[model samples]
Target: MCNGQRTEPCNVFPKNQYIEVGSSTEVVCQTTCVRGRVFWTLDNSPIDESLSRTINSSHTVLTLRNFTHHSATLQCHSADTQQVLGGTTIRTYSKPSKISCMLESENQHGGVPEWVKCNWEHQIISPLKINYTLIYEMPLKPKTELCHSQETNCSNKSSSGPIYMFTNATFTVRAKTTAWETSSDPYEIDPYSMYKIIPPKVKVTVLPDRLSVKWSRSGTYRICHCEVKYSKVVSDGTPEVVLKKTLGANESIGSATIENVESCTNYKISVRCAIDKAPWSNWSQEQMVLTKLNKRHVRLRLWRKIAAPEESEMRKVHAMWKEIPSTCQDTFTYTIKTTPYKDDVPGVNYTDISCDNSTCDFDVSHHAHRISLKAFQKGILLAEDSVYVPATGKSLPQVTGIQASPLGDVILVSWKAPVQPVSGYMIDWTHNGHQYYWKESKYTNTTLSGLLDKKRYNITVTPLFEDKTGRGTQAIHICSRVGDPGNVTITVDPNDKSVFVSWDTKSQEECSGTVINYTVFYGTQTGPMLNVTVDGTRQGIHLKDLSPDTQYRVYVKATSLTGTNRSSERLFKTKRFDPRLLLALSVCGSIIIILVLSLGLFCAIKWKKFSEKPVPNPGLSSVALWTSPSHQKGKGSFQPFDNPSESLFDQIYTEATQKTSTSPLATSYNSNPAGGQTEEYTEAATVVAPEEQNEKPVGQRLCSPGESTALLSSEKGKHSPYRSQSSVESPTSMSNKLCKRVPVKQLEKSTPVTVYVTLDMFEQGQSR
Candidate 1:
């Protein structure tokens, strides 16, 4: 820093060289000079005097409320020094925008746009981390690619190639930066006037050994002349003869003839066009043509006769050949003739046979034979073949020891081969109405399937002689039944108390005859047997209503046309119920019920006794009553009834009778209506000996009627709440007169004169 007194010093605030728009900042310029005067300017222009500015000591402050266009260079100067002291360009770094792109014609022919050139303008920075993505769009397809370039001399790759073209296609370029992206409008170039000429169309027709080709130009390109190149490629590396033909200018369509083309040969023909002198339109797309194929003569090749196992005395021979069909085709027959070497049998010496197909088979006689084959087409002999058959001294092997083992469901048939070597053996079997044949077998044993389970079958095996040269040629036959069916499956229905039985059937090979039906037998361990029949198509049957909780043995038998076989029986136990336990529980419950009832009965008896009111003890309850208006009291003997009918007297009498120790006391209670007198008395029945009681008192007064108060001695210690033991006071009865004391003895002495008492006498009195 220099002192303005001798040298000037100028400075500016906002030391940052860059600022963003829409931001407020304070700029200050300071200068030490002869006078304290400083000012600020933008972009080398003097600041507006009207704009807000402050004056300080040797410094000026300029307040920029906000930066609108911040790309200005801020300048600070001293008025006294008359020079600029400092300046800075405040880089705003706005986002990129306003992009533009166009196609360059550098690599193009006339009026053709080739390479993609793009132009973009940005306010922020040039050569900015700018990446351009170009979108090339065409009908039905749009492809995108990325490129990086600055604002100048930037263009994409050329579109003049076949796969890539600008015609009818538009390109859009977009620029991307760390901050923003902007895309330019789309641009396209028309290729109609461009130099790229579309390939012409070619038509072809084929004839015998020749191809006729016609070519025509497409689009608006005028051709001065056209050349057609015709050639065919061949093996052996030799150049094929190529024919070329030229046509005059203005001839858009022309025909060329290619002759001498071998049958079945393919040829390629192409035509190219030339403008007034421009490059020949890329050879008009090549056209391919083919001539018709020609058929030729036939050839026959016969294979040597190989011995077959299943053939009779004659050896089997096969002949095969190929024949090329002629253009004018006709049916042909392959003929074979067998000529025996020995010529023994007249008819078998020379046997000629013919077939309508391509292959022919001949059976040579027992001896060494000669075979001849010929192929004839349209009555013309095209080829012939001869085969010589040699006979071996050995004969066909004898099939012996043929046996069949019933292997559960399948039947295994095995045989022993004859000691002498033979070609092979054949086995044939019929099962379940189906016939099966096996020939040319290499193994000694074979297994058969689809047999009826546990059924019988018969199968036969024969050792075949290829040339009838064997001494013994008897076939081995065996008849046997299939093994028992597979294990019987037992299913028990717990709810229905039934069992279901099932088994697998024998294989077809084991039992070839029809399986009539299946019989299922089931029963409990100690019960009668039960059986069910199932049809041939069914293998299982359900037996319902069977005993529950029982053990059973079950077996399944399948019967075929041959015979019936049985499966192993299965032992099954049904569910069990414990009757003893249930009976014990019932008895216990009954016993408990009986005990409860007994206790209830006992309580009822006690309650009945307690509910009863004690009939005043006969001895204690005593009273007197008059019999009639005469105020006379009568008495009668009280007889005890063994059965009383709801009465207190009967209760007292019965009580007295039961207690013999107590005095045999009886009380008769009676009441009279007229006197309203009630009388009651207790009598002691003393069966005295004749001397004890000489007389009985008929009527006795224990208390005088005048003594209204009937006094009783409490010394007895017996009482009824109704009557006081001391005395019962009441009005004296009118029958106060004394009654005669007639002795019972005198009465009886007189009553021996027969005194009769009736049931009406006891009904005379009433008691309250």
Candidate 2:
């Protein structure tokens, strides 16, 4: 060894070298000690011997052709041992090239200033991580790093100012790895050329004759050159013809008018603008517009029917036609000419018939067999047609097995071919013997469309030959074929055990079908389904024997020859009680309550009246009547008493009896002292003894029942209390006379007697 350290067996030159992609490079493996035989292997795989050349015994060279790998390890080894001695990693790289720079704005449209964005078109392939730096230089400025990134593209977001347009700048990308670094070729550009323009906003207005297009100004441009292109929107499977126009530079609101556009037509339009001479911007959003209707004449498809001659030799020719669908316009009239078959025959030539509403009727002579009709709007002919009628004769064979069915708003009619050969068939349908529609079909089946709903129609299919027509087979039809029955309604019956179920059809036309029938499905919400069938003509049915007070679900299904339709399900609850019985009980209860209240009011009023009436007193009957001995004396025969004091008592008794009836308090004597005659006497007053009368004042000369002696006393020196002592006769003498006539008795002191005297009586006695 040259030095103190031991030397390796073999060493590879260019250790860990980087090379360009798709390029060939040669590596030499040499021995340090002596001339040693060596071989080359790449990444643990043996290299081809042809690619490796041995110069002498010590050096071996390996050539890598088209090295596409990122990195590969090359090793030098002894030919005999096959062991690795020294290795060098060969890395392939690409020089970053074709760099492109642009000025980008943050906003979609032209609003914010621009930033420099540079991208590397050439990719560097290397195992080591490579750093990319975007460098830009202006005419007067030094090259500066715009951005440093590990990606292929980088933006100069950290720039202090905006990138001005029209400024010439040079951009380059420098790529570097740990071992080597390379810069891309510089790209020179003008910022103005790299700026992008936004699409303009477009608006379209539909007009009667033309379309008007307006667009907002192009991005940040004062004057813009715009182009307007439009194409008619066709629905008949035809290619659209696009029309375009180039306009000069226009101001902020750019507008263009496309003249001579078709009326009542839809068109798709777009607008694109370019700033001066720069590239054209993207097309604006597409717009659709419908032009207004123009006032134009519409050609009417004329059809007519010529009736047979009547008995009066006047044939009534009924004609009805409709306008061919086109742009809407004003009404028009028709000119009908009924020409005779021969020149010698009589006929009528109606120059003009004012049919304002598309129908005309007139009577013509029987000889007039040929008819010609022309429709005109304001003296301008729109459409014309002529027909020749053939006389009634043997008709052609009629079509057989004809069937008509309604499909929504259309009537489909099909029939078997006639026995005789025919060119085609003419299908005609009429509504209410007035409006008519007909079409020619080469097939056996045809659909009659554009018919009204809720109206009956008579359709006929007649076969047409070279010169004649076969007898037509007629069938009745209606439009708007019946779907599911409409709106099922239910009403509970008054009997509580039944419900009246009814439903409606979409129209009366749906009800005119011959094979229609209704099946009503009804049941409780959770019970098995029950059904009842009804005739198609009937709209309502009475369901009987239903459970009362139960909720039920119901629907009506209408079955026709075409299809079956069901109405929406409905819910109804049955009544719990009989309505008629409850109504009768309610009426009776109201009447009884009124009668009871009337009786109570009447009784209360009667009691109130009786309580307010004055009551008659029974204590003030006449005292003299009881004292009289003759019971036969009438009440009117009574005379005034002899003593004035007795008159006071009579007046007081009369006043008391006037206010109320008097009743006797005590019955003293009813003895027959006159021998076999009885008289009733009641004690009116108690007679006081002479000693007791003198002992007290006159007004105080009253005594209790036990202290009273008698009402009348006939003892000597006794004065009658009913009379004064100053009277001409002695009190005892008059009392004795009265006692002898009436046999008056003395009441014992133990007898209970009640004496009622007025204040006037006491005053009179005191005065005496």
Candidate 3:
């Protein structure tokens, strides 16, 4: 109460008061018995509603909003009494975020196999208690394994005794947190594939005075070291020291050169690799290479190396010999011989051109010739050029019909050889910025797999005749997976019981390889199902014989050699139409279309007639058409009840008619009810109500009779516009009446709820 007077019964309604998160509650408080500002506070903090407050002569409304976690004490204070009038409390809660998963391999000590671990991580559990649950997916199995250690570290290693061992199949796990549980995305691991590592493959190429051996290994395992052993294949059984070389962990697919090796000496070489602390891999198969041969060598070449002209006869030839092979220091004996370029019978002619000289020349008739010369020391044969005649310079047909298929991590290439007899075909391709080619012996098809993904590859197949390589047929492709089909649509044909489905791949460049085919799984619910596979060259299909009015669920799966991708499922209904009804509708449709055309023609004939009617001017006022003569703007605008147009607004717009007679200003002013309008603002002050003398100390001036404000105290029979003057038994009379209405607004990531708390009203000293 303010100044010992009752505050208009000051009834804080007896009901449940609930406050919702991020919402406003405007408590329209009318303090007609008191004056001055009504202060508001929440949680002992002054309410700063400066932007949303509304004030009137009799009512002061202070809006309160709960947004900062929803718990606060709201109150209205009477400035006159310096006391709390009413207050309430609010409350709210928030949910949590998602969890994540990771899979990693931890190497084991001694010689034990590695272990595969699945680790889960989640953070966001402050101000609340949270727990977790984990489950692992088993490949080709009906049930999943509920992990025992849901805390942090989990594994499918042998030592851990996991539910399932890893294999060629995919392995994945899922996890979630408690108390508003949120599931994590599936996690996958490739650790189970470690056993598939292949033995190191070593190939050797013999060079003069040395042998170059290159070896390569496969699989995802990290190689710790590679050891290679090489030795000469000598006939003696005596114990001989073997040469060895080692490559560090950073080396794979590398070469090693063995020096100090004699020419024409066959050497055996092999390689092996191992991971850290694990068992060494099996040694590669023994390979052989030969070093440079002993004794002096000779070479012969025809001057102006081109083959002799068809009509020409004479040709020039030259010969050169070496004593130490690489140096022009000493002279050696030379013998020249001739043979057909296709045959090696070198006894046709022998010219002993020896005078401690190295090179000699001669001329002869050109007839597809071969010239061979030798350096002999005491009749000892040394090195010889077996196939070094001039090239035939002949052209061969190109290999054609080349095709390349890139699977997930592999590429398969094949080609058709030309009709001409081909000795072999050379397949060429580039990968990872490196060029590689291999020879196939007259094979029509070939495959290359394990291509790096997202890489562009160009392949060429060249047909070879003997030593000649011809022009190659080329094919190009990019390695990637076919993406999901886009915009798959299902349409029904009512005239025929069928469904047409369509979709597009749009960009062949988006795929790692070509999309070869499409498989569609579709059927009516709980009815017979049919699977259809279509050629990928086409993008759509029409499925006939489908039952009418049936609901079918269909999805498209685009397939490539690498993998398959399925589109989202679509549900469609087949239209059922009776032939008779359809014919009737067709006839009616034709009639309607004809009627529309006829109506258009009639309107064309009536165009002049319509023009003959007076057209309203755009400049004319539109309001004149709605208003009656009496309700016109200026001529004593009539009330809606007085108009006779039967407009819907007859009762809604109940404005009174204008007054006919003018009265004196003083008379009109005196006729006003609110203190004759002259002293409306200068009314007598409010009065005080007496309480028990024991309520407060005596002699205290709680209220002044001269300062009492007037109240419009009216009886039930008196009129009132805003309130019901004659009221029945009110629902508010019961204790169940609600004092506050709260709305809840929550962020998309969180959920909020309403909480109710009682309002604690405070009283001031009752001064008597």
Query: Of the candidates shown, which would achieve the greatest TM-score relative to the real structure?
Result: 2
Ranking by TM-score: 2, 1, 3
lDDT of 3 by residue, 16-127 (tens): 2443335556665455656666777767777665823546745667665555444556666677776765555544322222323322233321122334444555533233
Instruction: Please provide, for model 2 over 414-501, each residue's C-alpha lDDT reduced to its tens digit, 9 standing for 90 to 100.
Output: 9999878988887888877766778889999998876776456788888877645567788875444544444334444324788888
lDDT-sorted candidate list, best first: 2, 1, 3
| lDDT tens digits, residue span 199-290, model 1 | 45678888755788787764343544556676764564545454454455556677878776655566777776544433455676667765
Please give the distance, in angstroms, between residue 405's alpha carbon in candidate 2 and its true position after superposition: 27
TM-scores of the models, in the given order? 0.25, 0.38, 0.24
Candidate with top lDDT is: 2
lDDT of each: 0.52, 0.62, 0.49
How many clashing residue pairs, candidate 3?
13
Whichever of 1 and 2 has more lDDT, that candidate is 2
